[model samples]
Target chain A: MASIKDVAKEAGVSVATVSRVMNNRGYISKETRRKVEKAMEAIDYHPNQIARALQRSQSYFIGIIVPDSNHPFFSDLIKYVEMRANEKNYKLLICNSLEDPEKEANYISMLRQNQVDGIIMCSHTMNIESYKKVTFPIVSFDRFISPNIPCVGSDNFRGGELATEHLIQSGCKRLLHISGPLDLDILSNRRRDAFVITCMKYGVAYDIIEGAHNKLTFDYFWSFITEKLSPEELHKYDGIFCSNDIVAYALYIYAQQQGLQVPEQLKIIGYDNHSFTRMLQNPKLTTIMQPSDRIGSMLTNTLIQMIEAEEDDPHVNNTTVDVTLIKGDTT
Target chain B: MASIKDVAKEAGVSVATVSRVMNNRGYISKETRRKVEKAMEAIDYHPNQIARALQRSQSYFIGIIVPDSNHPFFSDLIKYVEMRANEKNYKLLICNSLEDPEKEANYISMLRQNQVDGIIMCSHTMNIESYKKVTFPIVSFDRFISPNIPCVGSDNFRGGELATEHLIQSGCKRLLHISGPLDLDILSNRRRDAFVITCMKYGVAYDIIEGAHNKLTFDYFWSFITEKLSPEELHKYDGIFCSNDIVAYALYIYAQQQGLQVPEQLKIIGYDNHSFTRMLQNPKLTTIMQPSDRIGSMLTNTLIQMIEAEEDDPHVNNTTVDVTLIKGDTT
Candidate 1:
């Protein structure tokens, strides 16, 4: 491999001059720059990114900490995040924390050791102190750590309001709301809060069912609807509001097997309009559409700005983008 | 940030001696190593990974090239790949090439420039020559680029044969096969080849409908079955074999909406039993299951071996793991 010294020798320039030209730190004559460029091309000298990153203290890399990329929500989020990051010449270092606090902390330290420019935290298992102590730029998804660490997510409260009000308007008397465990300090709890408030405001009776764990799993959705909710128990509700599209899909199967008339005897709505759910076209689950692409763009843009801006500047504030209702066949 | 020189001075050792201790080079007394380690901890010194990587030419990074992480197939593959890679102390740098030749080419060069230890190719858009020119360790998924680059994939031929034979044994007179474009030189094409052979051996009539593009999309599956296949056109087959689970799910929806009974009048089976498909548990999707976790483990393990082992040794050969048939209500 040709070294910088070789390029400098070919360009008739000092090693220091070549360094300046490569880093573009110091001013150089046009002819000198042209000669260095020509020499580099002639020798096919590829600049060392690690060396350059070390010198400039910029790795041009973004570390993404997600619970699991296999989940539809995280998969779509990771997809858009990687695209925006790659478009900006930033690579993504994926760390699947599996929602484990110890693993999350270890990944955080590892990413820091790797000198990533910024980190996008989609998994939050540790306390706020862990994130508050981090001096580097961090942009979180759904979860709010501290006031200084900005959080990016959808308008969960409004999303709940739209789904609840739409269900009521569609002639649903009683509703069953199934969601993930509400114990975690996540921003999505605002949706549950809104559901309760809306039900009371409309003078309609509603009940909530929490998952066995903090995350959404196929087994959780499948078991609850099929085994837990017997025909007698299911007859209590005329409508259902699920935390995610997967639950809505499971309910769709349960209703089909039970011979329950949809939109006539029961109405169902779900959250997070995932692309994977598009195959459910016959009776598409009505869902709340979270703009994954826009959110990804926002998170990357915010993190990059934080990385570029001076440290002493005031911290960037949190962001909550809008969510819309995608009316499908179920409702 | 305390430097190595500070640690050396604190330990009353020369800088070169400290370097030798840190790198585990040549020999060093146990007492001397202890002194260096204690001094390093006392001064709170963290080794500069960038500098160390520059010297060792190993970044402890494995670049993952996938078409898109949002796709269930790629998402599951990436999830398992990241898990296995992380367990081995290798961070993943994800590249979603979107199946574009130009983007794939750019990602290859970028991963190379970043000095990734090895690459796991899940997306192949470029010609085989492009991969042949790469001197670094590369392990491919599904696509066989060349004999030099080892490939890891499910036994796609076996998976197809199992699905076809099951359909035939179930007493299907005519079979409809839905698959991705066969123009691409992918190992999965063996599935199509087996599907034809199995149908012929059983003396069953089989017709294939290729995707409008190289990849599966909701629009293609949705439009073709619902809008394109009129009731008269759809009555020609007793069973359907889909290339993926998503297409099978789409057929499920189309059949129900068209008032066609499943497994009774028309049997359907899909490929790649994804976790997301588990919610289809009522009349569950009878499909061929590819071991995503095993494939991921095999790919990463193979690539890491090629990285750690001698480069001069004969290149590691291709690996094909087993696939199983997942029987559900659809069959």
Candidate 2:
């Protein structure tokens, strides 16, 4: 628990000399710097970071806000962002919003008060006004808050078109699209829009079914799909596109429990090529591969650039990554 | 953007009084507190957290270190921990070690320098010496570094025994166990120990396939599984137990791709009943449920207690949670 003053005293130098040595700021004689360094090593004195942040009026930290860290999509994104941030010598502060607006607001205020260099927001529930008022640079992921804020996401519309086209080409006469909560105008909505357009183009009659709720729960999905389609109605659709892999997997399980044959009776496709999709017992989940790692790396890179420049640029606000269709056994 | 001086000038109080009022410290009249509050509201002044932390010599922040956030198990654990920590008015700083000892050490140093009140470490590669040297209270999840450090994990031995017993009861005479990296002496090793003992008690022949390489990749798993079991040898075993859901999922997919009938030809069981396990197309994954959320909440609660206590207790170093065998289509 040695303080900077203790190191300075031991090194026979003023506190300012020790501070300069620690920050590599102000000029100090080589001998004096060496003495200060030796004293620091002897006492195992790690400089007080809070004090340094106060002196500089900035913390070289970035805060990331996500709805749920457990979701594979967000976790994958977080991993890539952390990797890129580390490469740039930036520390990360993570906040799990749990899809609560109040929690998201609290975290936003906390990040602001801490004077974080930048923020990467992936949470969907916070008020847009709150983000507009943020003094620090923010890069929104997937969700678009305002034209003034920067956002990075995959081309959801194209992903939807690709998935639908693949299903149609596979000889699916009727299609069903299982969508997430329609409130947030993000990639999910874009995908749904594209699904409708693609189906119309293929001259296929398509029906849209919203999962009971926004949260991807197995119970909710099971009930939603079962209640929406009877055995007779189920026979009509040959293909199903789910908003995400979780829903697709749920449909697969529920359909099997209900004694329905897969691929012969129904083909399933999912969004987000999550790790779990490959683990499906059927080994057949054709999915849209959103470049989660690339988005994360790009978000971090963009935020770091803004931090270094110390300004916001509306011109570089919306960046979209390409999404590819990963064809598996289902198609 | 408004500074304390502006608020003080508007409130008709000294800068020191305004500072004290903002922090809710020092003796101040009720009228003065109200006046400062009103001034702060009118000016939209947010206190600088770095300055407050420096003055207090402690940041009300906790650091979390994990191998990879992308893993479902870790991501789920992190979510619960973050939720509980937020409830307790503590912010979280996350560091992903990516299973690199050097990166782990560097993160620990950074966490220490940040003056975080405590740290919850789930990284296995972190050096034990570094743990001993940390000045802050640390609560380890899923991994034990030393006898003195507090560790919170599920009863891995019991989990392993239950999984093995379930497989044996399901008419499996021979079994194969796939494990994670063994050098870390983590819960996986404890599970392996119990698996051996349980197999011995039941007079069931079991073979263990070690996939404990530093890098866990598809190639490593594919090669290891293929090399360990020739087609004739594979047919002899009726059950497989995996250390984690990820490995089990990989085994399931590889087996199916190789034309092995699941549950009929190979009954598979995985630990950490992840969200994706049940979502598989065939739902052929019966696994052990580790109560990840409970583990996360308990670890945070214990860490908070240790951080707030006047003196540390040596007896509260090891805490264990119960695990349950989740019956699914695989068994």
Among all candidates shown, the one with the greatest lDDT = 1
Candidate 1 similarity to native, TM-score: 0.88
Best by DockQ: 1
Of the true interface contacts, each candidate retains a share of 0.74, 0.75
**Candidate 2 lDDT tens digits, A70-166:** 7777878888898898887688888988788988987888888887888999987866777888766899987888776788989989988998998
Query: How far out, in Å, is residue B297 in model 2?
Result: 1.3
User: What i-RMS does each candidate reach, in Å?
Assistant: 1.8, 2.3
User: Candidate 2 has which clashing residue pairs, if any?
Assistant: none
TM-score of each model, paired residue for residue = 0.88, 0.86
- DockQ for model 1 equals 0.57
| Candidate 2 CAPRI category | medium
Instruction: Give all candidates' CA lDDT scores.
Output: 0.85, 0.81
